[model samples]
Target: MKVIHIAGWSGSGKTTFILKLCSHLVHRGRTATIKHIGSHYCALPLGKDTTLHFEAGADPAVGIDDEKTSAVFHGICLDDALNLLSDSGVRYAVLEGFKGMPFQKVHIGILDGPYLLKNPEVSEVLSVLDQFDDWYTPSGLMKELTDEYPGCHIFSWAGYVTDYQKTKDLCSRIEDEYGDDPLIAGIRARVHRWSDDGRYPVYLLMAMNNPFADAAIFFRAIQKIEVCTLS
Candidate 1:
């Protein structure tokens, strides 16, 4: 999933921008959003069913209606929230707040000055509140991998391989051998060069229905592949 954070100081139009972006993405494809309620006390009513459940120490109290379901998770971190979104199969996630966490950022109204200016992941800066169209384009917002995987059908595996050559050889071998296998389907490999550590991060995402089974088969075939420490 592609995740980006919209960050700015209080009243800098962070929420507005996030709402607009979410609307745009939902119109095109599946999208999920997370709002970081930093330090502020939640305004859930004093005596509501969900609020009472929370007070009774039921973590992640949930309430469902005909049209929508709302969940309240106490003390849930950003990563945990992201994991939930991923499990729900959201294509994109827009995070509002959590300015300290290191993820891609979209800044509004320039509150952090030089800090945001130097951050490599700060993709765009919008000085004007109404300039949403200028900053956001649904087609260009995220990296396009369609040329590599045409249907946008992909399953990612981020793990360590021996080296670049070994990674290439394994990908080539997989394509030659299991590319036609019904479970294996079309195997396309993209070696992500950027890594926090020196270990090679090889992604073997493909077009397949049973991704887990196919991934197991693919990894078993490549003896040099190792599970990555980072997700």
Candidate 2:
């Protein structure tokens, strides 16, 4: 899953950027946009199986739209939505509101905290102030931390994370070390459309708290290599 996320304040143009990115990527070939409505509630149709099931107290009632063949899981993590998005053939995914996710945050500019994070699994993270530790599906931090993810989860955008010039410099390093078949090609970063104070939750709960504490002991086990390169 190539996940490219936009993080910033509400009025920072995140939404507009998402639209533009969609158009840009669509011109390129294939891509899909996914928006995160963190902590928001939607009342399922009264007669729908999903709604009925939830009312009947199913821990998480999952519903499927026969016409569109789309599945909806209630009370599931935002990551769970990723599972669905990946399977749907969305080659390039644009994450509109995953400020707390470890996917390289693509901001319009500064990650204004009000629109950046929420419910961080890692302490000390107050929106724009911290990077996501990627707890549930533990990302690179240290070996003990990697061991906890339990599955071989590939980086969402191991081939298209674009932004800083330093990032471009890193790509050159990867090419020199790995040869012509380097994964990244160009910078994929873009200025977003939402930049105001947050209208959505920035943080969400993940599994762990302090991956860094464990990171210190297993530094060699984790490699902070960029999985995705810009376009």
Candidate 3:
């Protein structure tokens, strides 16, 4: 599990960068992402029964629908969010916000001031997410995915990222192992935290050079490799 925190001031394109990062990961056929809204203003209207239930003292009143998007009234906590993703079994959770909280982060400041002195705890500080996916690849995975899937995006992960250094360190090793493969285009880690009460939401994927593989085989390869973390 790797956790890469994407942080910056308002209007600094934090959310936009997150969206693009999600796309790049998905194209590589890796599943990695966990977003934090940092706000509880998005509440359901009280005109409905769900709202009434919430007003009546239910912490989280869920409403499942046929659209495949389940609505959880009130808001979502980090643990709940992680459990949801764990159940889905994604490769990683590219979480948004939760900044300056002891995680490997990418801090984007406008003026590019003296950030090194600040204990912001970011592994990579860049102007944009595009800059981070700066892996050298012969084939253009981004362009191909753009043409083939259009707006569809992919996310991937290797199990358990608790800090930026851990995730970034593993990525460096992954690059050393399969950096030559055309499919191994880019590497980004999302900082995340989950619980053990329910099943884990994500299933880690293996570091592979070949872009094509059956899911079972990929799962096996992922299981064989051990994840290394930096403090």
Q: Is candidate 2 or candidate 3 better by TM-score?
A: 3
List model 1 lDDT by residue over 166-227, tens digit each: 66666677667767777754555544433456665565555556655556665654443442
Top candidate by lDDT = 1
**Reference-based TM-score of each model:** 0.59, 0.42, 0.43
Candidate 2 global TM-score: 0.42
In TM-score terms, candidate 3 sits at 0.43
Judged by lDDT relative to the true structure, which candidate is superior, 1 or 2? 1
lDDT score, candidate 1, position 222: 43
lDDT per residue as tens, model 2, 1-231: 355666766676777666765676665435666777766865577787767777888765655555654334555566556545544444466777767766655666456544333322212222232242221111222222224444322222222223434544553454354333222221111111121342211111112234434333222211323332223
Ranking by TM-score: 1, 3, 2
Model 3: per-residue Cα lDDT over 112-210, one tens digit each: 332231222222332233333221111223233334444333334435434544544544554465445444333322222333443222223233334
lDDT (Cα atoms) of all candidates against the true structure: 0.58, 0.43, 0.46
